[model samples]
Target chain A: METPTYNTAFAELEELVAQIEDKDIQLDTLAEKVKRAKELIKYCEEKLRGIERDIEEVG
Target chain B: MPTPKKLSELVNEIDATIRNRFVGQAFWIKAEITDVKKQPDKRWCFLKFIEKDRNLITTEMGGVFWSNSYNQMENFEAATRQQFASGLEITCLVKVVFHKRFGMRLEVMEIDFAYEVGKLENERKQILERLVKEGIAVNPEGSSRYYTQNNTLEMPMVFERIALIASANTDGYRDFRKVIENNKYGYHFSVTDFSTQIQGDAASALIVERLHSIYKLKEQFDIVVIVRGGGSDTDFKSFNDFELAKAVALFPVPILTGIGHDRNTSITDLMARQHKTPTEVATFVIDYNGDFENAVMQLHDRILVTSERLIDRARRSLDTYKRIIASSSPETIMNRGFAIIRSNGKIVVDAKDIAVGAEIETIMKQDTILSTVTQKQDNGNTNI
Candidate 1:
């Protein structure tokens, strides 16, 4: 699968957070979702604050 | 070389002939105004009436508006909402006037306001028709509102790579750059300038060429922005050209136009994804990125709050379980003044369970005592 964009990753993270807050969620599923949510959060954070993104004038 | 004639003699003959032919009769003539020179003190103007065929001047005539006709010019400007200067097409009443020394010219009298307006509107309508025929624009359900393919494209959440199409060193470009470069959020953009003439007859073609150039490097830019500072309607005329509008409408990358005009959205503006002032476009880009950043920050706060809540709840449950286990321990019961007795490795709960002279071990919180039962007596009440 292709890597998710910042927007896509953020959207997924939000869904996982909603599931984590549900009282009836299965513990095993909750654990899996939490792990994926952490990865997504890290991806979005790096995209927003990455120093490697630089400006270059092509013309 | 025909017998030595005075220069005035021949000039007078020509003037007499012209005056006799026109007889001071005002004739309605159609022409484009050019080289208009207005004299504020005299309240009159000098102009040239020209006829063009395919961009080449075919016929030209000197014309004049005397002081008495100044009001007519003002009225025409007011009615048409157009400046009565060079490049204006009009049908005006003029009388042939010949002066011995000044030669011959047309003296302007009245202008047809409707003719001027109708001509401009007709041209615009024709271009719009051609665009529709070419399938470049869609007027859904035959309604007044229409959109082109470029207009239907979705703009990105934030634009980081910019292809700026503008005239070099113009205030619009400078203003746009200033806002983007100094955005409060410090968003960095990679801007490439594709400068071209943005006004005059050749502007549309020049702009079209620049669009093609940007197409070659389309991957380098997220959007193309066409910007120019405010100018007279004539200066913005090129933006209405069919060729330029078609190019903009067919462009693969989204185009944003901010060629300033108080009224009348140009065809190029219609084909673009969005249109606004240069400063406004800059603000929009900055604000879009700001919105995303705000959302991310909010999400981060929510994650923190939720995790803390979950952890606190789990910690409370653990604390309850620890209390239950600690309170049920034998040491805790012994501290409450209870003892345990075992005989033959079994708990002695009743007198029949233990025989006469049976040995037993008594356990208390702090000591173990050894004892033997001499006789067994069963009592209904085993109260201590």
Candidate 2:
């Protein structure tokens, strides 16, 4: 399975930030955005410190 | 075959003839030294002087430095601050001598330290010139398309998967791992070490091969990092190889180099994002992701602040509307000593609207007074 690229994760985070910053966002949408933001932050932070280390050999 | 002299006799004759030709002559010869071995007594230095054709070794000859000449070589290295080690290109004054036992060997007499430095400088210049000509060197003006190929790649905000090129047993690789693995922010780096020769003649080809492998799996890596621990200038020659530099320049993914030379920059450095050391490269990756994390944190704060301000504004608006509604309410007006009159289930706003002898009701804040209209008055003077 393919993992999300950093760029994709970061772009989603940026969009969430934008939505949260909007003054007219609906409460429901705001909640959704905040939840997504939390998820992205957690995912990114975990990736940054995750203990999964894999080293592959190639020609 | 019968006329051929004995092997030893021919060898002796050949050795004597070669000696007679160069016995008393001494001149400077330039070549790269390898397989260096210093005697335990420190009285002699034995090495091979090699000539290369491109990346391949063309010729090699054994050479020796006697105690006196070895002492001179040490002084030369000290004065120049360049180590006399394997892979060093040196121009040294030597006597061409052929020994019956050792065959052809150059006897070191004097070392030309300046010439060695010049040779290195010249090689660096040539590499730089070629890189510029090939349009692979960095040009701030964006005049060269090839130079911008790897540099212009959009760097990922977070560094998750890294394609690392280094020797497995090197301190550079270890330092890189230590820095990333123990980062304070707990940033995880999915690093894959493509172990390869980091120095010497085959270093360039090995590194290029690893890069090709990574390129094939470019989707798995965000960037390619070429790092090494500190080394002598001679060891860094591989980093300056034209082929390796070209490969780095043309790589699909962005390349980051940390070859660990404080004084000199290699051609590969010009073609890729250069860092001073392996640890610094690791720090760069961490910091890049940290910036994104910080932005997320800042956004979280902004959301809190802006939402609070919005809620406060909404509450104030609701309070103002509530006050307006209360002030205009009929009950509140009636409580303030005003009366409402109704006639036949209809509000009678004017005295003329009610006929004489009509029944009417007066409404107050908490009571209803039933009464009959005895007279209807429309003028200033009224009798009830």
Per-prediction DockQ: 0.03, 0.02
Tens digit of per-residue lDDT, candidate 1, span B155-255: 77778999999888887888789999999998999989999888777899999999999999988888999988754434556887999999999998889
Query: What level of docking quality does candidate 1 show?
Result: incorrect
Where does candidate 2 chain A have its weakest 10-residue lDDT segment? Answer: A50-59
For residue B304, model 2's alpha carbon misses the true position, in angstroms, by 1.6
- State the lDDT at B267 in candidate 1: 76
**Deviating ranges (above 4 Å) for candidate 2:** A1-59, B1-43, B47-62, B67-90, B95-106, B138-147, B230-233, B377-384
DockQ of candidate 1 (2 decimals): 0.03
- Model 1 ranges with Cα > 4 A deviation: A1-59, B1-5, B13-25, B32-60, B64-90, B107-116, B231-233, B339-384
CA lDDT of B127 in candidate 1?
Answer: 89
Clashes of 1: 0
Clashing pairs in 1: none
The TM-score each candidate achieves on chain A is 0.79, 0.73
Best candidate according to DockQ: 1
